[model samples]
Target: MSASTEQPEHLRRSLSNRHLQLIALGGAIGTGLFMGSGKTISLAGPSILLVYLIIGVMLFFVMRAMGELLLSNLQYKSFIDFSTDLLGPWAGFFCGWTYWFCWIVTAIAEVIAIAAYVQFWLPHLAPWIPALLCVLLLLSLNLATVKMFGELEFWFALIKIVAIVALVVVGFALVAWGFHSPAGNKATLANLWNDGGLFPHGLSGFFAGFQIAVFAFVGIELVGTTAAETADPRRNLPKAINSIPVRIIIFYVLALAAIMAVTPWRLVEADKSPFVELFVLAGVPAAASLINFVVLTSATSSANSGMFSTSRMLYGLADEDHAPKPFARLSKAAVPSLGLLFSCFCLLLGAALIYLVPNLLTAFTLVTTLSAVLFMFVWSLILCAYMAYRRKRPQQHADSTYKMPGGVFMCWVCLAFFAFVLVLLCLQADTRAALLASPVWFVLLGIGYALKSRRAGKPDQAGS
Candidate 1:
């Protein structure tokens, strides 16, 4: 693609209401649920259901706060915009770049996951091949137009929704019929409590589950990035945000419950996906392969979302002079081509990581833990910005049509919950390493922000 004589100044608002809805849906249902739920079920047992509920409810409030703030000013393209406006330029600088890193880390994990999924069919295939191929395919597709990305996510999310619904329905029928697996495990609701019960592994196990479960929700806030291109955000954004709880219950809680009921919690494989195993246990002909294909697409969908989000974030940062000025340029399609290529170049490292890390699960946990920790920072910044918005813009809050349910109080509550999850990260060895490495990102960002401020001959708000 080449630049035209007439260059558009901004991203086009071509994404429609349906696009926003499915994008939000795609964001809400992340790769973690499909790829990581087995480990969560094994660690937390049936108590994992309660874990999802707590996280879901808390994130719903976070979304509500984000929605209110984004709608309060149409000028805000994403949460980073509000972070900068409500907090300071330093907040925007840090938030924008950290968010960009967050998605890159997440896309790395998704690519590794895609390679693992491919190995289900070809056990000897080089993991890097699929990983590299996925990145290149996403780069080509995203470079076309923003609307194309939306269309891809729309279908990807739809496939996931249908697959989960089918899994639930089939699981219920098997349980009703008292279907017994080859291993002699009987299908029944009693499976939830028959073995060591919900907290069988104790509270320690339940707490350990949060580390990976937090990764499950990594992309939940993705819709916030669509504010710039979404058509009728006021009408569409609220619709997407309000339905999060429902989607969580149906897509996550119900699907996992059905899987556990069919296969029993004790029998779930830690490293393998339960979504595919459930069908294999039920003796569904070629069904496991079909489900594997669904999960592959699911991971691909997540990688696509990551690519779209990271490029746009870089674009936002450049437009504000927080990044290289050339990153601000757009292609004929109104897409940030240079930023997208830069993100893809970074993603290629993920392929190398796959080739280097012999233990796939370890690589996944490391990247995901780091990704989750950064995402929590981004979420905290949103809450902090919401508190600032409340203090600085009381008149706007009072006059606004859609208000956050608990306002500033819930912001504090969400922030506290995040802090607690961060503390939980210290429990495990793998997660602890990621946690220890996290502060280095902030240190680098602080130094970069200070230098940039000095070059511009402005007060270093980041240092202040």
Candidate 2:
């Protein structure tokens, strides 16, 4: 294909390398590390770090495979589009809609969590107020130019990065300077395994952590969805992807290690945030207030990312004729206005649900677990798509600029790892409830697809 033939005028690349870099970083760091780490530590003790490392390695290869497929076809704006072309319509439709649902569900949880975070300062305030404000704030931001979205995400991500770096630095200082609690214990690495080895709860505890550990990595693939708008995707895309492993190690593994070192893993509370607890333990009277600010921003960043990604997924689906054509429309600023508004409207349901169910913990558990289930489904599809691509396009595989190492074998391994995580979900009662509740989403998608197919069969416009 010639250069002009390969490139399309309608699709412009507007994201710079800096934007791509920060997008990847923004995608990786979220409420998971800021708030969810406490729960994960409670489940598996210090061994949770190992679980995170394993999951990170598996997802790294999965992303490499996706990047390889995406870089090969300029027409592929998202993984779902590439899957459809390489596999079939079914793969495309399923991947696109499922991934969109994943974001919506995850966004709802983030919004509700944000409301809860805000309540720390204003205990008497109504939750719905903050949730509504968050939705509107993110919606307005998303309606602006894609470059503006990139800029907003850059600052949001910077806050998270700086917070984590500060935590690590302060934690190490406490350990080195021999800071002691009233109980007379100095912070040190010994906290990780001294009380009862790393796996204090035993091997079963380590395995159990996988259920929540996987959720931490849910939005890591957001970089893949941004390919359509990335400037010089060939160079910038690889640079963004190459940072995944390093970021995972820094943000998840090392960050967690530092937290567990400063305080014993067993002391971390499942219901309270570990970041807040670390500050409180360090004798900062306003730690709760400071951490609340960080958690609030983290929640906003996650919701902002959800809106951006869900809209792009809709745009890709429309481009592939899997979704309504209206969703493909772009605003003057190159934003997917229709899709953005639709997703923002859907997010309002989160506020409504929070009003109905005032029990914050219960509501958070239901939405987040469901989000994890859907994310697993999407990741499975990516692995399956890669496997299909390898089988059907051997020559493309041979000449690809970016390739998945140990192609077929790694593909199978990732798929199996996902399968194992699913089984673990089923074994855990909370996650199992989510698994039972998730099929309704697929059923709804099936009904929608059937109606759409019927509408397209009419005589008015079957032939383009």
TM-score top scorer: 1
**How close to the true structure is residue 153 of candidate 1, measured as C-alpha lDDT?**
92
Q: What's model 1's lDDT at 314?
A: 92
Look at candidate 2 and tell me the lDDT of residue 12. Answer: 53
Model 2, 1-464: lDDT tens per residue? Answer: 12243323344577799988988998888788887898899989989989999999999898898899888887789998888987777678888988888898888888988888888889999888899998998888788778877888888888888888878887888888877877666789889889788898898899999998888888989998899988899899989998999999888887888788888787778988888877787788998888889888888888989999999999889888998898987776677889999988888975686678678567568667888888878777888888888888888888898888888899889889988888888887878888888898889887776667667684433444
TM-score of each candidate structure, all chains considered together: 0.94, 0.93
Expressed as tens digits, the lDDT of each residue in 205-233 for candidate 1 is 88888877878888889999989989888
For each candidate, C-alpha RMSD in Å? Answer: 2.6, 3.8
lDDT of 1: 0.88
List where candidate 1 sits over 4 angstroms from the true fold: 1-5, 123-125, 353-364, 460-464
Alpha-carbon local distance difference test for all models: 0.88, 0.84
Worst 10 residues of 2 by lDDT: 1-10
